[model samples]
Target: MCNQARFLAGAIFSLGLVVSGCSSVPYDGTSGMTDSNVRTSIYSTLDSTALVYTNPAAGAPADDNPWRWAGFVMHPIGVGLDYVVNRPLYSISSTFPRATGYTNEDAMLDAYRQR
Candidate 1:
């Protein structure tokens, strides 16, 4: 019974991974930003870890803000998550043809600016 349960769980997880790769949208930054596709959603979620280290006020001088302190405290954690979890997943996903997501930060930023 225990073995059967483990097999069933593995099967379900594998199915989820396979189903997630079915997106027809290309990962050209802009298309992924607009398209409601699984690959883009996953990439966006992972990439959002960058926010913790980024300044809350864009193009402005750093001020004595509490949010800046919070960001300071969280910066190391965000960096670790980006390097360990996010980048690794992005690297793995990019290996599969037609499964490439937003691996380029510059492209993603350009897309966001265009929007």
Candidate 2:
């Protein structure tokens, strides 16, 4: 009976994941549907473009570690899961008023301008 219950729970969880994963709406930065709304950190254009090219082409030696290969396989899956779970929550939270300080874009741009 316990085994049957566990299987049923797992099936339900899988179904939820499948249903939630079908979001077709593109993330255009703003939390709200309008451009006037400030962009939230949940999905940042800056973050998606945050990759740094520290080395020249063919400059760095590849690691021979097995775990490095495992990470290479898993990184995209983890990032996708993080986005699927957090994006809606962030959008919901953004509808509420913030307590203080500038929005994320303003703060980051201001810091960059200072430098």
Count of residue pairs whose backbone atoms collide, per candidate: 0, 0
Name the lDDT of candidate 1. Answer: 0.68
* Candidate 1 runs further than 4 Å off: 1-63, 99-115
Worst 10 residues of 2 by lDDT: 53-62
lDDT of 2: 0.64
Candidate 1 displacement at residue 50 in angstroms: 28
What are the RMSD figures for all models against the true structure? 24.4, 24.9
CA deviation > 4 Å runs, candidate 2:
1-60, 98-115
TM-score of each: 0.31, 0.31
Alpha-carbon local distance difference test for all models: 0.68, 0.64
Give the Cα error of residue 56 in candidate 2, in Å.
11
